[model samples]
Target: MFAMLRYAPLLAIPAFSSVAWAPPMIRMVLLMAVAWLTVIAAPSLTPMPYWSDGGGLLLACSSELLIGMTFGLAIMLPQAGIGMAASVADMQAGLSAASLLDPGGQHEPETLLGSLLLLAAVVLFFTLNLHVQLFHLMAESLRVLPLGAVGLRLDPEAFMAMVGSSFLLGLMVVAPLMIGLFAVDLAVAYATRSMPQANVYFLALPLKIAAALLLLAATLAYVPALIERVFQDALARLPSVFGA
Candidate 1:
């Protein structure tokens, strides 16, 4: 149980993503396997044996939950950035009306281009072995956030800054593509001035999509770099989440 608390930051990752890729039963088995490995790997990671005291145990659990959530949120920020950038691209390309139904998670609707970008980012996440790095980070966090410590100090301004930086990273990734699409819109707008009978929006949609698709193809070479830049920034700021 203590090990599980330590590993709780990773809990959201699988919950959000792996559930879509792996079956629930498989995920459970894998989770149990991971929990066992974590316990075996760090047998000395237990909190005080005095945790049997109800109130103390509650405090410890609450602290762990809060801290774990903070760390998990830090790690997930890059994924959020990807979603933001994709949404911008989709909206710019006039594809916001078209959505893909997520097969997992209650069949929620997701923007088509956004889903594609997210899927690519997830693939790159594993390809870059970030999962392994995440484990290393989790283990390292145990040092600063040892169990049974019930105190938390958070810097609101630092957190707000991190959020802003995350969005900026997203914008960096899609800026070129968006700029091209904006140019397309400008060109279409000027050309449509002569043809008053044209359905400007309807006609512009396909042109923007084609331009977006082309820009995306050109943009693909940079996605690995995008993931690298965003995650690097996010991970570097992880220790701050504990609040200096």
Candidate 2:
């Protein structure tokens, strides 16, 4: 039990960071405590494979920790990639200038699009009951990959596929805004070409901003569906992470 407790922090770190509403420290503590209690009480509620001695017990605990960390990483990687890609897109779109630091992400510059993605992720997790599903999955994984068994193995190809999917999702989410901004730019260019005396840069800036805002407002309705798909994909790919 003490050994499992030591590994609880590893399990908590990724799950806690993924949640947007909870303070980082509080999330971490909550998840760690949950993991600790789950492991400590496992023997009483379920049949645990018997070990011969202290040496066997030590090996079992170490293996459990490794498996927990691997499971946590599988969930965290996609979210981290999505957040990073969203930040890049926001920077390219000139939206990074007015970013606030995000405490959950270690004070990184939190761009508008990044914040939206994070919020969407959080909403989908709760609304779809993904939090409950994820906890159930974690418990099931323990049965399949028991203590003293080999640690869960990640498949590189599948992981890369998920990463690609996450990037594509991010692009799709921001595509409407980009397209609107591009149209505004083209219109401004045409106006400048027809009337060479005009100051196109100054005139186009507000137009671009207004167009972006309008498009964003219009696209708000589709956001819930997009978020649901992303969360579904995240959950669907869980088995692949453990090479299942």
- Top candidate on TM-score is 1
Candidate 1: residue 2 Cα off by (Å): 2.2
TM-score of each: 0.85, 0.73
What lDDT does candidate 2 reach at residue 117?
73
Q: What 10-residue stretch in candidate 1 is worst by lDDT?
A: 11-20
Candidate 2 per-residue lDDT over residues 103-170, each given as its tens digit: 46565667887777776766676787866776777667656665455344778788777767766775
Off by over 4 Å in 2: 1-11, 14-16, 19-29, 40-66, 81-85, 99-108, 195-198
Compose the digit string of candidate 1's lDDT tens values, residues 129-244.
87678778766766666656666677777777778888889788888888999899888888789787888889788889889999989988988898777877876776786686
**Candidate 1 vs. true structure, TM-score:** 0.85
What local lDDT score does residue 196 receive in model 2, on the 0 to 100 scale?
93
